[model samples]
Target: MLVSTFHRCFVAVCILLLSACSTGYHGSFVERSFYQGDITGLNLLGPAQAEHCQSYALYLFPLKHSPSTQLAIKQAKRSQPNTVMLADISISDTTHWKIGYAKKCINVTADAYGKPPSTSNG
Candidate 1:
């Protein structure tokens, strides 16, 4: 009887620990965050998105270093080779934590723009 009771208690503890895992999200947006030169010649290609993540071992030491907006932006730019700037940008940060490990990620979504094809409408 005592062995059965101990097994039940262990199961309860495991359930509680698993239920304690949590996740959080934060988001921000900007009109233009990655451009500076002339804007009159740029054409909106389309929407683009990318994600960058960093994992923590033992909930302390980083495994893939820290996630950053810069890395996310770089990843996003890869989808479109002609993308020279981003507009209507949105950045979302997510964090998930458990008993043994944690993860942080950055998701970047933006409208990619670049120079249009040169043509003479004359």
Candidate 2:
């Protein structure tokens, strides 16, 4: 009886580990303008990228709210405080699972542009 229980538990653990899966999604840009009106006067602030992730326990109970592209974009824009808008935006999603833990993420990548921060020379 003891040997049988041990064997079953070991198999269960192995199955749990093997059943975990991971997937990634390559999303395209949505039909939306980064900025309305003309952008001729905006200065390029180079590229910015950010990711927002949410965790799940047992794939059923969420540890937090689902990640969002808007949050990711906001995070990316934080890198440049003066950034007024983004351009050439792209979005993607990634999911990773291991045992009873899982994480899903929203990733945003874009070119940030806005008026440059003024430097005060002393």
Candidate 3:
């Protein structure tokens, strides 16, 4: 009975270790914030300008550091985005908003979320 218990414990430990390692396969993405105020009073001159402005919020999510990142960057480079419209006049009192573009460097890691390893040789 003791031998069987020990074997079960050992298997459980191995499974936990393998599960931790498997998380390294996925990556993460970050979204930068933009406010409607900063981009107000700007003109977006194009045939599809109105449609682009309607979906502007979708552009806030940056590319993840994975295969998808390459594709997103390529698409962004090909299409230049223009700004249009301003914050609603009723909501102009808010000044704590931020608007800008951000570029993140790709980091390779052997752990999840590109976090550094917990164990170090030193």
* 1-122 per-residue lDDT for model 3 (tens digits): 99999999999998887456334434443332133454333443322101111111222443443223333333332233332321111100111112553332222211111112257789
User: What lDDT is reached at residue 34 by model 1?
Assistant: 60
Clashes of each: 0, 0, 1
Clashing pairs in 3: 40-86
- Name the TM-score of candidate 3: 0.25
Q: Any idea what lDDT model 3 has?
A: 0.32
Better of 1 and 3 by lDDT: 1
Model 2: weakest 10-residue lDDT segment is 17-26
Which candidate number maximizes TM-score?
A: 2
| Error at 27, model 1, angstroms | 1.1
Model 2: per-residue Cα lDDT over 1-122, one tens digit each: 99999999999997776455343356878533367757888888888789999998987578968888888989988877688888888898887777988888988888888899889999
Top candidate (lDDT): 1
